[model samples]
Each structure stands twice: as structure tokens, then as C-alpha cells.
Target: MAATITNTVIDLSHHNTKPDFAKAAADGLQGVIHKATQGQSGVDPTYAPRRPKAEAAGLLWGAYHFGTGSDGVKQAEHFLKTVGPDHASMLLVLDLEGNPTGPSMTLEEARAFVTHVRAVTGRWPGLYSGHYVKELLHAQKDPVLGQCWFWLAQYGPTPVVPPAWAKWTFWQYTDGAIGPGPHEVPGIGACDRDKFNGDAAKLTTFWKAGGV
Candidate 1:
């Protein structure tokens, strides 16, 4: 049941430092998703600075907000304000993992956040999580959350797709040391890597469509 990686995309934040987008492009990296904001107050300082650089390298750009225990609508507003207009080319995501910094976001809050995001952006943001999501959502079906594309975060051999989603759109198979190899990218030595469910052209279309 282990997933095979196509190595077309990657996701990063300030934690991985600045990457060499030129090298990454040469390495066949098609897109890059980075952390834009975390909670209401937290923002990734590197978000705006590296965007054009990544685009210059011909990599599709994306931003994700790490959900926190706050007013979901306000969080969505803050996330959109930070990310700017969608323009139909940039991917937007909701990171639904446990919040180590504070209280984790409840399913209710996440529902509100994603719904508000869809209401404002005219599209549903992708949802990124792993075991936490599986545990919470395994037995339940969420028509609202299910509308968003599922980005599976699994470091193990095989990933679990929650009952709400039929399958995963993107799989985060590694976080540097875990999951499958070749974990090293051209610019980044060891960082987060993901695989799309299709070929290069499909991946491009997916990115261009903002994971629609």
C-alpha cells in the first residue's frame, strides 16, 4: 500500500530556510507550497520574499495557513489578506495538524475556516494533515471538509485516506528523514517532499488550477 513518489513538488516554511529555486527547477520540481501564516498573529517572514524567486524559477506558488484555536472567520480573513488575491494560479491550503504552539483547532473551527475561505476565495483550500485527521475523521463524514482536496501527511509506508475523502490529491511522503527517498532536492538537502496522483502535465494543471 506504500505510495510511490513522482517528486514533482515540495512544501516548506521558515523552518527549512531559504531554498535555491533555480536549482530546484533544474531538478524537475514543478511547484512549491510554503507556509504563509500560522494562527492570527503568526506570519512566515519568508513568505513574500521567496514568492517571485520561486515563480522566476518557473515553479507554481502556494500558501498554507496552519490552523489554530481562534475565530475561524477571522483566521480566514487574515490568511487571505496575507496571501493576497488568488488569481486562479496560486494554491491555498489549510494545515489541520495538531498545533504544538497552542491549542489545536477543533473540527468546528476548521469547518468554519474552510467554508469562509471558499466563500471569499471562490474555491476550497486543500486540507493537510496525517494521523490526527485520520483519528478524528475516520468514523465521520464531513461534507464541508470533504469538498477540499485532501493532502495526506504520512511518513510511513502507506497513508490512510479518511472516510470523508475518497482519495488523496497530494501525499506528503517525507519530512526530510522519514518516508521514501530520494529525499534530497537540488537546492534543499533534506526537507518536506510530496507526490501528485498523476503525471507532470496533470500536476501542472492541478497547480495552475489551484488544486481544483
Candidate 2:
């Protein structure tokens, strides 16, 4: 299946079984955003180990934290510590989706998390969410969160972008099971795929700028 966007990105976690970053790059995959931590306790375990391999394969690397009901400040601390420093071009993200097993993070908590991230990193992390944020921030703009780049997660024909931002910085079109075609990637089958709202050069700049 072919996508309208030229720059493609794939997000992964412990749930993803195998990840051949070299093959994924050969298949036109430009980047990988893997889960880093959850709440203040849970760590992805695979995040650190996979970082070098993904980068060595010539794929842009990224790390994201799954927000929980725990203290956002604490979660941010744990997340950054787990992911280490960005070094230069590594992308950092905050997954703000509604959690099933644990309590979902409130909008206030979400704000705090991003704020702390910026405080530590000197750059706001990309925010990843779907209907959870869509409904939560319907027609309203959060001053703090708005500073962070939006990573819309909508498995549909068109993304129902939140009103806070005019458009999405990165749109998660599929999660392997839903959204558009080619839900599976070359190395990692049946995973989340994202479309950057820019060309290859712009995507590289976005990564280097952290969230431009």
C-alpha cells in the first residue's frame, strides 16, 4: 500500500516482537519512536537496548512516555532518566492516550508533564494522543500543551485534530489493526505508523530542532 506522505515513521514498544531497523529503513521507514516509560514506575525495558541498533541502521530514533494517573512531574523525571539525553537529533514524545489498565492522566497532569519535560530538556516533547485528547480539549486551547507539538493519533480516513492546534505536526494514521493500509512495516509487522507533515529535509530539521 502507498501513502500520500513521503516521510514515514513507526512507533514501537515491548509489545512489538521483532524489529529489524535496517530492513525497516530499506522499506522506506524514516524513523522509530519507541515507548520509554509509563507512570513513575514502569519502564519499557527494550528502549535503551534498541536505541543504538535503530540509530546504527541509519534510522532516526525517538522515545515516548505513556502518561498515567501518577504525578506528571515524577513521570517526567522517570522518563528522561530512562531515555538518557537526546545527544542531538533524537525525538522525545509524550503518549497521552487513555490507559486501560491504569487510570488515565488528566489534562492538568498532561500539562505538568510537558512542562517538566521542557524544563529538563530545554524543548517541549511531542504529544501523542487520539480521541482522548480530542474530546478532552474540544474547541479549547491549552496554553502550555499548545507549546508542545501535537502528534495526533486517529485511525481513520481523516484525523480529528484537536482545536488547540490548527493542524497536526505528526498524524498517527494507523495502529496496525485499523486506519489505512500497509499497517505492517518491513521489520516490525502490525505496528503504529505516523505521517510527518513535511518532506524528508523538513523531517530531519524537526528531529534536530526537537519539535520545530
Candidate 3:
């Protein structure tokens, strides 16, 4: 069987928007995908346009929250509310770029926050952030998210997985795309065939098991 290439969140800001890009690239895809947020806590009006394009091309969809000045948990709550969690393929994502406004929380606190949100939502929200951030947490072996599948954002040839993070289900490789919009992970072409790791049945089973 061919390995599935499922890069969950594609942030279509200044980068991915072009003439007929989203509408074009929606062909030959599988599993749930998300539109990444940009500017002032992820409330861009472009989501409406991007989503229909993907849906037209046959892709299950959702939205991802790029974190800002607020606490991680609070940011997550806002994202969940903003996107709502009952779509065809609903998966909330927490994008942790850095602590620009508020004081950075300790590793313990960050992990705890992730765990708390997962418990509350009953879904395994994804983590999208830099390699350095993962490395910092790796040193401490963050207990809160040892098993979470990472959507790593590294614009390069090969993705470097932090030792602490063992499994990497998705890797966002670049801000460029070939035929259409900016691909969430450009190097996904490096993989054979693309599909989500778990089908709806598997996702539902995981949810019931409280694995998120």
C-alpha cells in the first residue's frame, strides 16, 4: 500500500492567494484540510472563498487558528467557537508561532494547556510551529503532547523532527506551489500517494477512546 500524504492545514494568506488557485488545486486529494489564518487572530474574510473552492474540487474542510496575544487555551477556545466543531471533517488546530504579546509560558504550563484543551474538546487538535520551539520542548520531554501528530512548518528540502516528537504526520514545507495555491506542505510530492491517516470511522473510534 502507498503511504498517505495528508498535510492538514494550508494557511492561505498573502502567500497562497492567486487567480483561481484554490479552485484549481482541489483535484486529486483526500482527507480533511484547513485554511490557515493570518492577521488579527485568524478572522480573514477569505475563508469563504477558499473553502468553496476546495469543496468544489472534492475535499473535506475546516479552519485553523493561528495563535496571538492570548493564552493558548483561550486562543483554542476562540478558534473552536469561530470555526465550530461539527463540520464534515472537523479538527481544531492550535498554531503556536511565538509569544509576541504575552509573557511566554513555561514548558509545563504549555503542555498542561494543550492537554486541557484536548480533554475539553474531545478532539486531538494539531500543533503547527517552528523547529526551534519543538526543540525547546524536546529538551524537557513535554508530557502533555508526547503522542500528538505534528504539522511541522519548515521551508526546506528535508524536515528535521525534534527528538522529543517521534511521529510526524504532516510537514508544511514551503510557501510555494506548482500549479495552483501555496501548498501547506510542498514536499508532500515527495510522498507517494496522499490520504488522511485515519478515515472517518477511525477518527470516530479514536474520539470514543479519548485518544485526542
Candidate 4:
């Protein structure tokens, strides 16, 4: 059987703050859709390998903003400028987790930002958050998000994606991962590995089509 593209996302955020990044990425899986923060300074050194490795493996590569309360368009521009245009991410994720805690946005405002990201990037931008954020969006009522896909991070053994949210292309099932890295970070333990539903090509199209 051909190898399945059970894509993982590596975040550069401190493991405690964002525990899934290293564990998921270094799982030595087919493709990875890692994220990097923008608008402050430069790209993250840890997440640096995510894009190159994906490209090298002919695997799906994607990136997203940490959603630092910046306007979606500005964030998109910052990502493009930093990562360069050649690195075409299958999907651009707007991590909608931490924003609402501070001088961030409400669910309604966050949705608008997501739309703006899609408009500016010319690709489907996805939403990355836990169950609460999904609930906040009331994903059922406001379903059609152009071509965007959802990169759900509701950690568990089963696929906890809300049915009303439609098919989720990427499901992060666990935080236990182990591997080498761009920095000397501890791995997240062992990964479950059987959860991915799509292949690389599917992932690519899914990403380009906004993860729909």
C-alpha cells in the first residue's frame, strides 16, 4: 500500500503554550502544515523546516498566522513577505484561540478576519482552535466559508469534528510526539497516527481550495 499522507502541523510557539507543534511535525509523517507567528519580528526558527521538508517530500505544505489581533489582510501580507511567495501553503490558518482573551476579536469579528485572509491570500484560509472557538462561530449556521478548510485541534483519540462543520481534512488527535527539531525541544511522546483521511494530492487540492 502507498504511504498515507497523515499530515501534521508543527507550531513554533513554546510547547507549553502550543503543545502540538513539535510532536506532530517530527512524527516523520508524509506532509505537515506548520504554523508561524507574524507581525512582531521574523519567522520562527523552529518551524523553519516545516515548509522545506514538505516541499522536499513532495508533501503538502501550509502555514498560518498566530492571529495576533492584526487585521487579516495585514497578517497575510506579513506572512507572504516573511515566507516569500514561492512557499505556497495549501491552506492559511488563522489560529483563533488566544485572540479573544485580550485586545482581540469577538467570534463575529474573528469570522470577518478569516474572510479577509481568504480574500487577500487568494486561497481558502482555515480556522485553528479548540471546540469552544468552533462553538463560538456557530459553524452550522454560518457554514459556507468559500474554499477554506478547518484544521481542528480538539485533542482526543476520536475525531471530534462537529458534523455541522462538515468534513474536516485535518484532525489533530494527540499531543504526544517525539523527534529531532530546529531547536532542542522535548518531543510530545508517541503519536496515534491512524487518523488522517486524505492523501497528499487531496491535501494539496484541499488546501488550495481553502480546505473545504
Error of 2 at 123 (Å): 0.9
The residue pairs that clash in candidate 1, if any, are none
Cα lDDT tens digits for candidate 3, 1-212: 75444433344443343424343344433333444443236565666566666566555455566555445566555555556545434555556666566544444444544675577765566666666467566655555665555666666655666665775555666555432234434323322121234554554443234334
Clash number by candidate, in order: 0, 0, 1, 10
Q: Rate the local accuracy (lDDT) of all candidates.
A: 0.88, 0.86, 0.51, 0.53
TM-score of 2: 0.95
The total number of steric clashes, by the backbone 3 Å criterion, in model 1 comes to 0
List model 1 lDDT by residue over 1-212, tens digit each: 75444668899999987699999899888999999998987899999999999999888999999999888888898999999875478889999989887999988899999999999878999999988887777778898999999999998877678899988989999998988876889887798989888778888888898778
- Give me the displacement of residue 119 in model 2, in angstroms: 1.0
lDDT: which is higher, 2 or 4?
2
* Candidate 4 residue-wise lDDT at 151: 60
lDDT for model 4, please. Answer: 0.53
Q: Residue 69 in candidate 3 has what lDDT?
A: 47
Best by lDDT: 1
Instruction: Write out the backbone clash pairs for model 3.
Output: 5-194
Per-prediction CA RMSD (Å): 1.9, 2.4, 6.0, 6.3
